[model samples]
Target: MKIAIIDDNSFLISSIKEKLSFFEEIQVKYTANNGADLLEKLDKDHNLDALLMDIEMPVLNGIETTLAVKQKYPQIKIIMLTVFDNDENIFNAIKAGADGYLLKDVNPHELFNGIVDTLNGGAAMNPSIALKTLKLLRNPVDFKDVSKEEINLTNREVEVLEQLSKGLSYKVIADNLFLSPSTVRKHIENIYSKLQVHSKLEAVQKARRNNLI
Candidate 1:
């Protein structure tokens, strides 16, 4: 029944701790502010049985942390405790090897049950999340599409990429967009750097592949 809590918000950490305090079987081992902190702490002392992980965090997020932790400590169970119930977040967390998914506002009894169920080799998902998981199974979301946010290209950059994808020359692109040729060239250079490509064709291809254009 030893567990660790990882969250960026100190108040939420305290709240989770308070909820678990009612259960004598659950021992709160340590608290971490983010995934990096959690990893560092685990490196020092990884004698815990499970973790209550928060999704949105600084440095490293819950999903990334879960993947890392599971790779290193396969025996340690991980339960995602977060405010988000969106399909994308839940799907990503599950894909990252989460043993359970529960909302932050879950009742103490239900939260304790989720922890126990996860530790007992059962998946624990909130009711809504469970339905979402079923739907996800029925129609799987493309993970590549889920990762498009990582690139985070600006709207103008996407517009420039779209124009470039049309095989337009830089001068023509500039004229069509009402910009100078030098500005278009600079924009293309920035796009190349952002897309990690050497040429217009590669940039366009990568952008299309990532669904950014």
Candidate 2:
């Protein structure tokens, strides 16, 4: 997979490159010190499969870079790299359309796995930041606008949506439902499209509004 690495720390960049070197399928096609350099490189070579970007940098931070890339090259997946895991940073990064978030201290194999997972259309929140991400978007028990009378949700779909709202992963939901994770994901995709939403938070709120769960 074609990839780009953007960070202010040259040594860290080199280390990541060396780590990823074992994966013959993965290639570090581009490297940038900051967002500006990343953008410049993209302007010249836009065939990248994913971008690994740092949260803090000299010219532009990872959040802004993600927003810019999402606005312009919406197809390119972005994996945020950070040494610090803060709420504000996570919130901003998610709002800016980050596909995944990873700490600088991640093991090489996990990092490669995260990249592959993202390429295959899945999110890869760093274990250190997953709880923060959950806190960032997880729904409270008292969801507003729930209908008293059930409004057409299947027992299974309601169960799925409930698990989704509680932050149970697709795999976990599938395990709970005795269905495949891919099937669960399809259900979610259907749920999102039917709800006219993009993210999990929006789907849960809309489902509550329509009394789906």
Candidate 3:
């Protein structure tokens, strides 16, 4: 079956390729370092049967990527292949329509089996993950519009974010807002914290996606 791999770590990508190399039935169609790159490639090649995606990436993350891919190509199975196994990550992944969830350190044989099972219309989740999924189903959490939930940015924070969206540097943003650079930096820190994003690009993307800006 045709497959694609997406991960920011080149070494991890190579390792996954090495593990899949043992299986003749699996063809590695392409590799991308991030979700945006993968989407561009998928647009060109949409022939892939499945995609092995990482959860943490620049530009776009695995959860967002999975959501986008499922919306565009529901037939293509997506399995999140990452090391993160926390409840939040697993829950978000399921909510994003992942066909399976496997750790990056999964054994080669099991990885191959999981891929085959997923393609054959079965959810391939690790035992722990499966248990979590069941528990989540038995007692569903109140998600309450997670993607667009109000982040409650302050007026100053909103101003800073608007300036940020214009691609202004911290100094320029400070100058425009008539605030000290240190204050601007503090506001950005608060913004990242409220947004639960790590980088500027992720913050901006999430802001735009949620219409916070």
Give the root-mean-square deviation of each candidate in angstroms.
Answer: 10.6, 16.1, 5.7
Q: For model 1, which pairs clash?
A: none
Ranking by TM-score: 1, 3, 2
> What is candidate 1's lDDT per residue for 1-213, written digit by digit as tens?
999999999999999999999999999999999999999999999999999999878799999999999999999999999977777788889888999999999999999999999999998789999999999999998866665646768877787888988888888889888989998888888989887678786677568657887
Instruction: Count clashing pairs, candidate 3.
Output: 0
> In candidate 1, how many Å is residue 142 off?
0.9
Q: Residue by residue across 1-213, what tens digits does model 2's lDDT show?
A: 999999988999999998898889998897999998999989999999999989877678788899999999999999997876756667778889999998988888889999999999998777769988787677432222323424455577778899998989899999999999988988887777666668886678558646677
TM-score, candidate 3, is 0.68
Query: What's the TM for model 2?
Result: 0.64
lDDT of 2 at 154: 57
Q: lDDT tens digits, residues 99-208, model 3?
A: 99999989999999999999999988889889988898898776546665878999999899999988899999999999999999999999999998887877886788
Give TM-scores for every candidate, taking all chains together and pairing residue i with residue i: 0.69, 0.64, 0.68
Off by over 4 Å in 1: 146-213
Q: Cα deviation of 83 in candidate 2 (Å)?
A: 0.5
